[model samples]
Target: MDNKIRLFTGGTQPTSVGPFAVNEAEQVETRPGNRPSPRELHVTGTAEVSYPADRASVRLSVGNNKTTVNEVTSSVSRRLEYILQAVRQHGVREEDITVRKFLHRDQEVYHMNAEVTVTFSDFDQMEHACSVLLEKLDRSVSVGQPRFFHSAECLNRVRQSACVSAVENAQQKASRISQLLGQSLGAPTLVREDETREWRSHGEDDEEEDGGGGRRGQEAASTQVTPLPRIPSVTASSRVSVYFRMRDGNRKKY
Candidate 1:
């Protein structure tokens, strides 16, 4: 049996005995077959683009409460009309607005409650509608802002930019790595790609309240709106992946 000791950590010595004695030259030679050729390299590249959004969408909710479900629903329907009228008056096109959701549910404090949601296209128009409903209706109504958005063309363009960036990045990285290894980048022998989309929302979420910080009338007249208005901004992002091959010579394709 044999024994040997080597430094394992600060002020620490580890011992090896019997079959534990290590062979440095044998280990290096054994792994030579597994070592990668100097000319090969792998890298990831990325690209991004930002553009102003050209459109917006928003939904507004209006509701009423009463002793009975039917009565509450009828009351909400009546006042909601007025609310819609006010929104329309602000220049929101009829086609742009849609009834997204509506419901009549029982409330413990009030007995019956009704709610209606309207979606609009323009941000400015949505804001204006909310302002009028809060003022002209002279009652506290739930007001929500339009959601900003971008066009499909803009999204596609971003994707293409990302792809280009990824490929270029891979090429540059491969070139540097090959240079360090005493070789040159080569044409891509194997290639692959992937992508992703991300969306971020910007807005304040305000609570929906009845008439005046409290529930009141059963059948408030439906709110009415005017014409339509301007759009809002929406942003989208994409990511790309690429693979490149490296050779031992400078004759490489981009």
Candidate 2:
């Protein structure tokens, strides 16, 4: 048997641990390959929120035909003024009222038309104003059905809440899936909204249509021929795609 002994005479010596020897210079060097990306689980989440209409708009119009433009305009103006007064009396703001006029000549008779669009925050006041106009003007003026919708602020909040709900749903789904697959759920790697949609649902009362010219007397009590003043709801939905880190469930993390 032959035996050999080695002596080290250097500024720095290599340290031996277990089966490998490492020096100060080798410790500062990075490993050859970059770390691999973590395992990811992909999922889609969807959520929707429904909110009742907050405000409404109604359009009213008056028209008259006469031999002279002045006469036709006068008649239309009187009715238009009366409509404005009624709308104002119901506590509607001035900025909420929009008025438009049109005058045209057809052969011998001159026709003049005036339209009033009013936005109302209070549904009761809107109903009352429409009722007054219909009851007084009757066949002379046409009142359109009130179009109900959510306000800007309300819509923004609904959309944001829906998005947040979708993300939370994604996290829950990912957690359950990872648990079932014998893996651990980690932080979300990526999240993005993939799709969004908004729609109005009238439910059973969708049979209602844009009302025509006003009906006589007691008919105005119904208020634009709608059924029972049903409050329509606006529904907003959001879909998101999320990527979450997945780790081996059996492996202990350092």
Candidate 3:
């Protein structure tokens, strides 16, 4: 006994059908409405834009270790107060200053630390503040390196411009590729951003100290002989990716 079954499409006389198992004949029916897949092209585009820094930040620290907590706290507070006064005199606004305090107990000694962060929109004012602090403050007070950065508005504007440029770049690339293949680029069927990357450059200078006695004399003499260091400029950058579709010459717009 033969055990073969034949599949047919709309009574087409079996049309050289493939052999099927007896139990699988119901699942082998052919339909006449299947459609072919559409053709597509894939490409990626990227762009980068840079913006200058419009703001600066500096962190200053004061600390003291004494036998009693009150003693340590008072010392740190006094130094911090003087530092804040000097900062404000240099044109830094009170709202732009942030303060933090920490206390720790060690064997037979109490330690108190205070940190003040000042942000400035003007580079000249920031430099003057740092110089004043290093020149008049006590040795116990330490000034950190100034950090430059872009404002929020600047960053947003640059990112938007970069993304737009990237899309334009993608369209130009697709048009050129389609032209080489004798086809014309059509409207974008899909647009996707692969990822966005941000780049920032931070500049740091060596810390300056208010030398005491002989050290101060040496620094004063050196300042007369050495040129001032140049302040570094902060740079912010953005990148993006884009995709577009391709069309035939009959539908080409140009």
Candidate 4:
């Protein structure tokens, strides 16, 4: 048997189709289920405020070397007791004084050391206490410079005020930018606080305290004592980023 091949042909060719026409309204309208994208503006603002220090801390150390630990310990304890008593007479509370460090190292001569800290809210009292310790205590006792800083309540209050000012600054910036674009600023879409910064500086009036009458005058008259240096003020700053919606005056809302 011989293999045979058969070919089949259609009677009419298919008609060529042209591109569909789009009306003006259909071209401009968005897809029925899709929502419009949001419009927003971002701006950053910063603010800072300074406050005087309300607290001061002083560190003192007592150390001695002797042939035996008992002798050194006894000597250090007696000196510390006298120092504490002198400090308390100037209004330092027992709770505000703390033993910060104690160390003992064995050697040919037994060495012992103890550190104490005193905190004060009143500068006059602090000055008086420091003067008494320096004039009356043994030379072995060392006094460190006082460190001044704002209290926790003061820091928190200043920080909050700075944040509020920063936000207001961001809003004003956004409003100006929106006006330039022939649009108005709507409600803020997002707000975030940025990293905060702080700085410290000695205030000008810090030296004036030494010249005034009080503990300063008494110390000046008797021993020609140098007035304690003025405490520095602390400045706190905050930054914030804000995103606000924009509304066009001529455009209708969706």
lDDT (0 to 1) per candidate:
0.50, 0.75, 0.65, 0.71
Candidate 3 global Cα RMSD: 15.6
lDDT measured at residue 153 in model 3 versus the true structure, 0 to 100: 88
Q: lDDT by residue for model 4 over 1-254, one digit each (tens)?
A: 11111111222212222221111111123577964444566677788887888889999888888898789889888888888888888888888999854656776687888888999989889888878888877588898888887889988877788878877888787777877878766676456665577777863334446545888767658896555557777787877766665566676422
The CA lDDT at 22 in model 1 is: 26
Better of 1 and 3 by lDDT: 3
TM-score of 2: 0.55
- Of candidate 1, the 10-residue stretch with the lowest lDDT total is 1-10
Determine which window of 10 residues in candidate 4 has minimal summed lDDT.
Answer: 1-10
User: How does candidate 1 score on lDDT?
Assistant: 0.50
Q: Alpha carbon lDDT of residue 127, candidate 4? A: 82
- Give the clashing pairs for model 3: none
Residue-by-residue lDDT tens digits, candidate 1, 1-254: 01111111122112222331222211112365565332224455554545555556655565566666677667767767786677678776677666643454445423332333444445566666777777865554555544566667766665566556656766666667667866555555333444445554443433345766443232232333332433333343333232234444555543
Which candidate achieves the best TM-score against the true structure? 2
Q: lDDT at 160 for candidate 3?
A: 74
